[model samples]
Target: MIEHTALVVGGTSGIGLATARLLQQRGATVHVVGRTERKLDPELIPHWADGGDPAQIAAVVAKAGPIDWLVVSLSGGEGAGPIAGLDVATLRRAFDAKFWAHLTTVRAALPHLTPTGSITLIGAISARAAMPGTAGLAAINGAVEALVKPLAAELAPIRVNGVSPGLVDTPWWSGFPAEARAAYFAQMAERLPTRRVATAEDVAEVVALAATNPNLTATVIEADGGARLAALV
Candidate 1:
């Protein structure tokens, strides 16, 4: 039914789920891997595996068969407070989800990835700019960028890159009260040159590009609604 296969880690929701849908729409057989099973079309093979666990990742990859694309879109421990206030366990949890999980996924999927296959790592705009309560996220995202270049070189024909998105509309925001969400979006809208927050679909488009575009490798294509440029100006 599908022409290619893509394993979307963290694909049960948010940007990852959107990406899985997009890829499926484009004729790829997509396997959605996450901590929980969810309601999705039958074509999307749902597999339960916490990205933070290496063994789980290995098992998922084994079931997915040969992967033409791998997308890592996991997240953890948001709003853990300032660095000085964050306890050891919180920091470790954050790292386990974003940094180590990414490492494990890439390591496990590399063997099965096709020569021309590609990987798209999700990062945050906070990695480039400073934010008070997101120290762990920034640190891990920077590490992801650091890993991208070396991994790209090591993987050669298998491209490795990242997509750093600004505040996008996702379920993560649903936890906040309506007032808080509006204020947050308003503040970001004022600061960003584009004067609007990015949509998950906007970010997914870039991820799709990173996964299928042959010319790009070891690059962090930013889809942050011009936040980076605005900060400089």
Candidate 2:
């Protein structure tokens, strides 16, 4: 937890918010940006901006001043469904919201990043997992993970990494009714080696590691609860 300044896009809630709080706890000056406003700690400098908009992202970066860690953890529109019934428009929206937004933010923050800083992109286990319904998510998140290797090589000295998380008890599943969500977690928990789902804090710890560890680059750490390894049934 070396002292550093960090900017976390999509930090208003969920994994992004958790990461921001964890960094702040470790004594990093953290600034957060999201499309909507939310109550945040006084120490966390907050801004509102759409991650998909280059202009807005540039403005947020400019306001944050030079940053040592740039983390992109925004959620795109849902693209999970069987290919036979898939809507191409949903996949396109997912890319627009996540993949392009990640690139846009990185490009905007480059000028303001510290020479020896780091950038962490948050993808999902769907990228590498053979989960059948997640084809669209795989494409979107896989593209994000793909950026790590090449970007790390090109951005040497300035580290670049990614985090691919599996199912966590985050708000992302809020669309499900409480009873249903709980049932879903219980079912998945039984199949996972850890016998539990991940917490947002659990995933945040990995993001913090990816951002602060100078030794790690071109790495994509999986924070799933062995969801990838378990049978997808």
Q: Write the per-residue lDDT of candidate 1 for residues 165-232, one digit (tens) a residue.
A: 98898987888899999988888798888898888888899999999888999999889888777752
**lDDT string, candidate 2, 185-225, tens digits:** 99989999899999999999999999999899999999998
TM-score of 1: 0.93
**Which stretches of candidate 2 lie above 4 Å from their native place?**
1-3
Q: State TM-scores per candidate.
A: 0.93, 0.98
Question: What are the Cα lDDT values of the candidates?
Answer: 0.85, 0.92
Clashing pairs in 1: none
